[model samples]
Target: MNGIRKALRDGLVPPPPSAEPVKHRDAGVWTIPNLFTLLRFLLIIPAVISIFYIDERPWLPLTLVAVFSLTDWVDGFLARLLDQYSAIGAKFDPLADRLGLGLVVIALAWEGLLPWWAIVIIATVDLFLLFFILLMDAHQAMRVNWIGKFRTALTMVGVVAVLAGPAFAQPVLSTIGVLCVEVGAFLHIITGVQYARLAWLGRRRFR
Candidate 1:
């Protein structure tokens, strides 16, 4: 029990010694995990172009979305697997997620596939959380609750389903897709309230 508590307090991996130089330690900007993050960002351009300009090429954009969304998981896994976690990657990963998710939501809303309210709610929550992070200086210690993670997973699943639905001309698929989005959005709102409560508690602690 004592060993488990110590491990939890100190983290599973030991920190590098102060006297020894760590490999690829130039502030962690040039690691494999960071590379995956950069790739995710670059994917956004092709995704946007496919959605806006290439109306006839639905598969292209859908594929990009699927790949881009999946890379969110990939980058995190690589970060932990390769021991390539870095402060920059930590921040960049979530930013990439927001950017990718935002782009998809905007495109879907503009195309009249999704309701504008969904976009507004998601954007508002994201901005509020961003502000809270800045206000609390909690970037390093910030962690997403399971509910938040589940919400993200549901959102991505819905987006992919919707994209696939129209590409294949399946009304049932589109219906299912919309249902997923609705459920995901509801969860998103709940998580947003949870986050706000946490932020309030954090503020009270500082006061």
Candidate 2:
């Protein structure tokens, strides 16, 4: 349990009081994980802008989304392989992810590719978590649940599909992409419920 907590702290939970601070990060100033995160963040601006720039370039947006999704995996892998995880990297990586997905959701809704209600729901849940994180100190940082991780993966895949557009000429491929999103949304709802419950249980403590 303590090791898990330490891992969380080292990776994004924020540095707990008990954990030592990291130093000596200015050598190359870039690790594989940081590079992945920077790439992911860099892709977001163009991806969102592309929604309005090209009418028939859905695939471009989808490609960017796919690449951004891979960043999540690559960063984690590099962090483990290189043992270069840092608290700043931990926070920045997840923030990049949320920013990427949040932009995708907004872009899709703006283009009328996805329902506004779904975007609203997602935004609300995200805000809920954001609020908790802002209110909590380092000690109370909420750990990412497995269900939440799965939900995030599904959500990114769904975003990629939406960006790919429905006119891909391959009906089955498109259908599967849409299905992945729907399943992702389902998992999202479950994870949201669980998170809400956890927050409610600790409302007094947080206050």
In model 1, residue pairs whose N, Cα or C atoms come closer than 3 Å (at least 3 residues apart or on different chains), thus clashing, are none
lDDT of 2 by residue, 172-196 (tens): 6555665676677667677777766
Off by over 4 Å in 1: 1-27, 133-141, 196-207
Every candidate's lDDT: 0.72, 0.66
TM-score against truth, every candidate: 0.77, 0.71
Clashes of 1: 0
Weakest ten-residue segment in model 1 by summed lDDT: 17-26
Model 2: ten consecutive residues of lowest lDDT = 20-29
Q: What is the alpha-carbon lDDT of model 1 when measured against the actual structure?
A: 0.72
